[model samples]
Target: MVELLDNQRTFHIQVKHTSLVLHVLPTGHVTVIYWGKRLESKSLAYVIQDIGRASYISDTDGIKDFKLEQLPQAMPTHGNSDLRTPALVLEYADGSRITNLRYKDFKVYSGKERLPGMPTITSGEEVETVEILLEDYLQQVTVKLIFSAFYEYNAITQSVVVTNLSKSNVTIEKVVSSNIDFLDAAYDVCYLSGAWGRETHRQVRPLSQGAFLLDSKRGASGHGQNPFLALADKQANENSGSIYSMNMVYSGNFQAIAEVDMHQNTRMQMGINPFDFAWQLVPQESFYTPETVLIYSDQGYNQLSAIYHRFYRECLMKSSHAEKVRPVLINNWEATYFDFDKRKLLSLAKEAADCGIELFVLDDGWFGKRSDTTTSLGDWQPNHQKLGGSLSGLIEEIGQLGLQFGLWVEPEMVSPDSELYRAHPDWIIQVAGRDPQLARHQYVLDLANPAVQNYLITELSTLLEKENIAYIKWDMNRNITDSGSSYLAVAQQKELSHRYILGLYHVLEILTEQFPEVLFESCAGGGGRYDPGMLYYMPQTWTSDDTDAIERLPIQSGTSLIYPPISMGCHVSAVPNHQVGRITSMDTRGIVAMQGNLGYELDLTQLSTEEKLLVKEQVVQYKEIREIVQLGQLIRLTEIENQNQYAWLYRSKDATAFVVSFVQVLARANTVPKRLKLAGLDAKAYYQVGERICTGSELMSIGLKLDKPIEDYAGQRWLVKKIEK
Candidate 1:
């Protein structure tokens, strides 16, 4: 709920267990007074009065108030006598760079409103909002700060809408989505950072007296950095203490910064990066920033993550497959690679269907003159030479076997040898006088160009219309380099990266809206672009290119910190794993992969009859518990480290069913059984486990013991169902 204490000049917004209090000072500048646990409606006027003395220091001129530098500003501005990191920076037509804003007005509403061209929380009666307006009288600019409070989630969504009200145009250098301040620096910053094939590794460091930045400028939410940051108290853990998190719902050039001022005050800001960025704001033109989610959890990191998971699962993902159980799919990428023919693919599909797999995805070899990585990337048509029949006929054959068909395409890449690229060499991103750099034997198409984007849309739409494709594995195998667009002017050339992301989002929006039934799984060389922005279009993303079970434990663990399980695409590949060459038990692989959208990557036709039976059983078991695994609350029972064990627990939303998956990493000479205490259960109810029944209290207090002297790489999965008295 959102309330305005007009008498005290304070705005109070509460959502579930969290509250945010903002006060308007006598100078009309807004500052955050308190943001943490839920608080009663009370006046904070005295708090403002205490800092009133600093408003006018004897050393400063009578016209300037030094207090603006001390107050915890809601949106700090540049050239306002405050030296902090400004949330709004602008350059005017007259060469003046001053921006001083004050509270103009505010409006309270019943439901949340969506931000244009961006992902945001869904609107409902349970959600409330307050939009506060701030204006710069000298520049004739208006800024609207929007806050949304969700009743079920301990989160407040924030965004900014900046409108130019002057007669001429203005240049916007930087405008952040949200800026928040804490009274003191008593927290540690936690973020996710890593490289390709080893993405989203968790890193935590203490907040010192300087600025710490977590950002991505690789034209995508690159594998090197993720757009998430959290500030947890020094004493915070998984279950206790105060935690503040801000995540940007954008895919391109983004920044998240935590700055500690001289007064020991800390300010956290997140939005689009200002480097190489300048937006032209014409008169009456409004620029809308992407929404940033702020979650306050007095209970700790797990509580903070739970709020994000619930919000994304219900609000961001818009496809029809968002709430449904995904099919147990088998992809032929690792199995056949670029060597599959019509007979080979049909054999694989037939075997996969017999093993109860619902879908078969033909990856990387079905289109163009493409048999290898060096050719035919831009061509989207089917290769009749390899298929030996019409594409629709093959799809019909697969459907006749009671299996769905999926195809893979790299729509944003073009090979130098391909027909499309040969015809239109200027379509790719490159400087006019330089040789375009190549990665993965391909050049990235300049999606920022309208012609290039339109061509791709036409090709993809034609294919989707011609065939009965149920799923699409959209892949982008290369990063952007030599970032210069031929269509943009010299001054606007620096806008290529951001414009590229906008173009990609535009294509996805139109395609997903037209074919809402098709399940789209995004892959940027596997998890490179696995972010909230992509999840808004595709419900799930391939977790990583490295499908090795042992390596995946840490990757999935760190990814789960910010993203939900339903958004991760995990696959069980062959032992002697293609990526890492590590041989792990198939059971261990299946158990690990089941924690995500479960699927298979290896050749099922090559398995022995007994192994095939195991595959069938795994498929059946996954079907029985798919709903709980996809929509349940996930609890990490064991920390992911270089230890002998890793475990996870999934509990139904209603607390009636739960499943625990445990894996023994390696064998030991002489070891005792490890006991794990489970969480999120009905303490008084009895649960049936296999043939035995135990009270939830016993499981929570006494714990469950693992099998002693377990074999290396052994895995166990246990299911418990609640029993009524």
Candidate 2:
């Protein structure tokens, strides 16, 4: 519920257990008064009166009583006499760079609104929205600060829309999505940072006096940093204290900053990276920033994650397969790579069907003149030489074998040796005089060009129309370099990265809308572009190229902080794992991979008869409880940081079924059994675990004692069903 205190000039937005309070100062500036647990009282006049202090005294004569530097502003702008970071920066055609925005008006609505050309939370009866308008009189620019409150999820969504209102054109250098100021700086910042194989590793540090920024300047979201940032109280932990997190719903170059001012006030802002970005805004033309999610949790980090998981699954992810049970498929990437023929694929499919697999994914080398990764990327035609027949013929054969067919394509890349690149070299992103750089033997396609985007849409649509494909593994294997587009003017070269991403989103939106039946899983050389923006189009993403189960423990755990399991595409690779060369048990592999969109990535024909039987059993077991794993509430029981054990629990929405997965990284000679207390269960209910019955209270308190593993890298999965009173 949103309440406006007319007498006090304070607006309170309360959703579930959280409340955000803002007060409009006498000078028409909005200042954030409080954000955290809901307040019991209504009046915030005391908060406004207490703002005057010696530390906040401004040098100006007329405004000595009201200081912009001391005020906890909702959105700070430049040329406003504030020394802290500005949320909006604009340049006028008359060579003026000053910008000052003040409150103009506001509109409170009943339902939520979707962000244009971006992913955002869906609204229903349980959601309320408010749009506050601010205007820069000097520059004739108007900014709209939009906030959507989801009562059920206890979350708020924020974004900004800047429109050029004057007859003259204006240039926007920086426009952040959301800016929030806190009265104190007693917090620690947490973010995810890592590389390709080991993506989304968690890191935390104290919020010092200066600025702490996490950003991705690459064309994609990149592997070095994720678009998520969180601030927690200094005493916060997994189960207690206040935690606030912000996740940018953008896929391209983005920035998140946590700045502490001289008065020890904390200001957090996130949006598009302004390093090389400049938007030309003509009269009446507007720029919309992507939505940023704000979640406040007083319970701890786990509670914070649970809220995000629920929101992403129910609202952000709109793919038809988002709520459906994903098929237990087998990918041939590691098994055959680029050396698979029609006969070889059929053989693998036959073996896979025998092992109860539901789908067959023919990864790479199926299209173009492609025999290897060095050629034929942009060309999407099936190679009759490699397949020994037409693509439709092979797909029909696979369908006759009682399995669905999937194909992999890297549409955003082109090989210099291929026909597509040879025909249109200008379609690749390159500077006028500099030579184009290549990664993975490919050049990044110039998606910012409308002709290039239209060509891709046409080629991909034709293929989908002609074939009976059920799934698509869309991969981008290289990061952009020589980031200049041929079609854009020299003055607009700096807009290449953001424009490229926008173009890509347009293509994805059209394709996904047209082919609603086909499930598209995104991959950027594995996990490089795994962010909420991609999840808005595809249901899941290949978590990483590193498939080692042990290495995946930390990777998956860290990713779960912001994304749900349904959004992670995990596969059980072969023993002596191809990525890390660590030989973990098949049981452990299956257990770890089962935590996500479960599948296999090994050569089934090479396994022994006994191993094949085990594979069949594992597939059947996963099918029996895939819903619980996909749609359940995930409770992280233990982390793999300093311990040799990692564990988690999944509780069904109805609270009747649950699954617990415990993995032992290393074993000791004579170690005692460990006890794990489960979460998200009805305390008064009785649950049947295996053949034993235990009350939820007993399970959560006394906990379940786990026996020591007989060997290293062993794991166990426990299934529990609730019983009637």
Candidate 3:
């Protein structure tokens, strides 16, 4: 609900258990009065604070106790007596950067409105939006701060729209999507950081009296730094204390920053990276920033994550199958890398079908003259000779084996040695007179070009239209290096990073809509571009190329901090694992992979008879709990920081069924069995697990004991069903 007190000039936006209050002072400066647990009282004017200014502190317009630096502003401008970081920075045609913005007007709406040409939350009846317009009357610039409150999820989506209302052009140096200031710096900052093979490792540190940054300048949302930033009370745990988080709904070069002022007040902001970024807003032109999700929870990290999970599933994802069960398939990437014939794939598909797998994904090497990662990325045509017949014929044979077909394609990359690049060398992103750098023997396609967008949409649509393709593994194995675009002018060159993302989203929007039944799983060399923006187009993403079960413990846990299990594509690969070279038990691998959208990435035909039987049994078990696991409320049982053991629980929407995944990373000798406490269970009801009956209260408080033989990389899964009266 959004309430505006006309007499007090205060706006209160409430969602579920949270409330965000803003007040416009007599001087027309808007400030955040309060943001935290909901306030049920009708009067909120008393919440606004004016801590008298210090001796040397600068005040605004000679008004005593009215300093901009000390106030929590809604949108602060630079060089206006505010020494803090500004959310919006603009340079006018006169080369002047100073401007003072004051509250102009506001509008309260019933539903969330989409940001033009940007990925954002879907509009729904349960959501309310408020737009606050602030204008620099001197410079004739307008800034619209949009806030959408998701009523059921306790999430508020924020974005900014900047317009050049002046007669001359305005160059935007930095435009942050969202910013919030806290009264005290008494929290630990948590962010996800890692490299390619070990992506999304949770990192936590206490917020000090300086600026901290988490950024991605790799063109993609890079594997090194994910776009999630959080602040939790120093003593906060899984089930208690306050936690505030912000996640960007963008998959591009981005920045998330936390700054502590001299007064010990912490400010958090997130948006597209201002580094090497400058957007020229012509007269009457407007630029829209991507959405940033802001959530607050005094109930702890679990509650904060739950809000993001539910919000993404319902509001961000545009796929028709967002809430549906994803297919339990087997991707052939690890099984056959770049070497597979029609007969070879058929044999594998036959074995997979016999093992009860529902889908057979033919990964890489099936297109162009591509035998390896070095060639034929943009050439989407099926290698008819290598496949022994038409692509549709091979798919038909695989379908005859009782499995659906999925294909792998890298639409955003072009191999230098391929037909596509040879015919149009300028299609790649490169600057004139500069040698283009290559990664994985390929160049990033110039997606900012209209011709490139049309070509990808046409090629991908043709393939999807040809056969019974049930899924697509969209892969981008390389990050962009030569960031210049041949189609864009030199003045607009810096806009390439954001424009390319817009182009990618444009193509995905069309293709996914045309093939709504086909599930699209995005991959950027594995978890590189895994942000809410990609989830807006594809329902799931390949969690990581590192499929080693033991190595995945922290990766999956950190990813679950903001994303749901249904959004992670996890698979059991061959042992010794292709990436880590660590041999783990098949049971352990299956249990780890089953925590997400389960799949197999190993050669099924090569498994021994005993191993094949184990795969079959695992497939059957996954099917029994697939719906509950995919559509459930995930409650992380243990923090991944523990390193030794990490566990999580998934409770069904109705709370009648629960699926728990517990993994022990390292084996300890002569140690007692560990007891794990669970969450999201009905305390009054009894749950039955393999003939053992216990009340939910007993299971949660007393905990479940892991008495099995403990070994390195050992994992376990349990399903608890409610006992109906």
Candidate 4:
């Protein structure tokens, strides 16, 4: 037997019959190994614990028939159940001895760059040893992980659950979170508990160089495996970027979702921090905490605690007076491309308002010298050739149709030919000798420059002041290139990232405070800049540019796991999805978009009356239950990974709710339940929404069981709203 080195001083746990060593490495890798024939994998023994016993229910639509046989057998009733379990769970092959001695067989490595030499930073100290204090949670089964010195691995991990059983009072404080890297696992998901899911806010204690860890979405081919997450840090990242992640999980119910938008935690890491109850352990007592993280095949924040709470409590959770309705918005990129004008916009706005839209957003072309990617980004002035009048006048006209006006701006970018760029040629993030590469007609602005930041702030403020815009679609089109800046010295260039983000934060802070009511939605070329940082200022994020309904099922599905639908900007675009060229049915598009902060991104003026009426009806329906869809408990009724069959659910605390199930429908089989084993129903009660009443047992067992034709759409849903108390 070989004894492993406890060099990091991370942990020393002693059980009655075993000893465990937990340590972290310089590469930001953590190692947790048990000394005996480890009994890994969750067991039914913990059934007395919350996870094994927590009840589940749903009200979101689309689940009629589903089989439990396809899911993993683990009893993950509470916490983030979908995160990948470690390979450490696999013990020895033989069942011989319980272990008199021990053998070490674990090695997890993060990406390491063999730089010419280690970096010298004037900022702080070089890490020496990781410190961990372990106290067996009274031996019955609890371990408290008391750690100092936040490491890199902390950000990349979400699957850590430590049992606390110490006899004396012990408080674990988060001093620092590390930048750890992991090898992509087949499956990984970081389920944020409570406030952790979105609107990430880490008040003061920031895991530097970090973002909220939403669950990982693995590509389809590898069987729900998140290939990106499986990646250990690549050697290439050694010189510059530093990535940090935090596992902010809270305990108990309603802990998996956010209660509000922009509602911040004491910590302000995009307000994406998780919620939790303190584990007040007594003598021999134990508390179990499950954190959200991803290591699975595929899966997948804002700030202001008040705004966040308002969003949830006011907009999403309010079941009374027809959910106050965030205006149904329409963006024009999917509608007109580069071929629209004032007349075209007004026409679309008219159609949209008739169909119940409250806001119309003109994307990309109205400002600067832009027509296509070849020119004009920094000139914030209106493109007079394209605009018939002053921006404010056009905005007022759009508003006259009973809709709010919105516009797009990429303040952190500039076109070389733009007026702003010509005047401030030194503002771009580039070396004097290097020719900056452009993406979508723009070069990145050096926000790190204090002067540039002030200029952006002034221009942004002026533009808003002059316009009647109610919303701003703030966009960042590209990543940093050349990694060098004239504004930053050699040492300062390394500081660019953190400083750049700080600069962004400064710019948004000024604008948001100055214009408290204007809603700003962050768009990073669809998704490139999606991190909790941006969400702090802008509660919502435009998920991706590809808006096809069929394509969105997976995207929306994965996004829903970590972010509330309200924060995911899903829109119904023109039938020939400009991105994919596939024409999805309008109803199908509406249904998918309705699942999120619903809107239109299509040329509505072209729709037939029948389709227009359908859209009108959808708007009415969304207004009616947007609260239920946004605030209620979310559950996956169907297997998310199975493409042929899709299912999900949401519900209020009451027994009444709905489910949405999707299936192409093939040959039938009785082996699979035709209906749901609908959960969270009180076995003792009877529920009646109409003359017909359902016993809890019936709903729990058969769930209004029915068998309909495979292609039957309406047959897939079983809406059961409760009447009986």
Worst 10 residues of 3 by lDDT: 47-56
Candidates 3 and 4 compared by lDDT, better number:
3
**TM accuracy, model 3:** 0.98
For residues 354-434, what per-residue lDDT tens digits would candidate 2 score against the true structure?
A: 888998999999888788878998888899989989999999999998999998989999999999999999999998889
Give the CA lDDT, 0 to 100, for residue 548 in model 4. 69
Q: Candidate 2: lDDT of 69?
A: 84
TM-score of 2: 0.97
- Per-residue lDDT of model 3, residues 1-725, tens digit only: 78887474888899989999888887888888788899876766665554556544565587766677887887888878778888889999999998788989999878877777778797464888999999999999999999988888888988999999999989999999988888789989999999998999988899999899999998999899999999889988778888888899999999998999988888889999999899989999999999899999898888887888888998889998899998899888889888889888999999999999999999889988999778898999999999999989998899888899999888999999999999999999998999999889999999899999999999999888887899999998888887899999988999999999999999998998899999999999999999999999998999899999988888888898889889999999999999979999999898889878999999988899999999999999999999887888889898656888888898988888898888887787788876888888888999997779998899999888886655688888889999975
- Model 2 residue runs over 4 Å out of place are 56-61
Selected candidate, larger lDDT, 2 vs 4: 2
Summarize candidate 4's per-residue lDDT along 79-136 as a digit string, tens digits: 1221221111101123221111111223232222111111111102111122232222
Question: Who wins the lDDT comparison?
Answer: 3
Q: Higher TM-score: candidate 1 or 3?
A: 3
Per-residue lDDT of 367-453 in model 1, one digit per residue for the tens?
A: 888989999998998999899888999999999999999999999999998999999999999999999999989999998899988
* Candidate 2, backbone clash total: 0
Error of 3 at 293 (Å): 0.9
Enumerate clash totals for all models, in the order shown: 0, 0, 0, 89
Q: Model 4, poorest ten-residue lDDT window?
A: 114-123
lDDT of 4: 0.48
Q: What is the C-alpha RMSD of each candidate to the true structure, in Å?
A: 2.1, 1.6, 1.3, 17.7
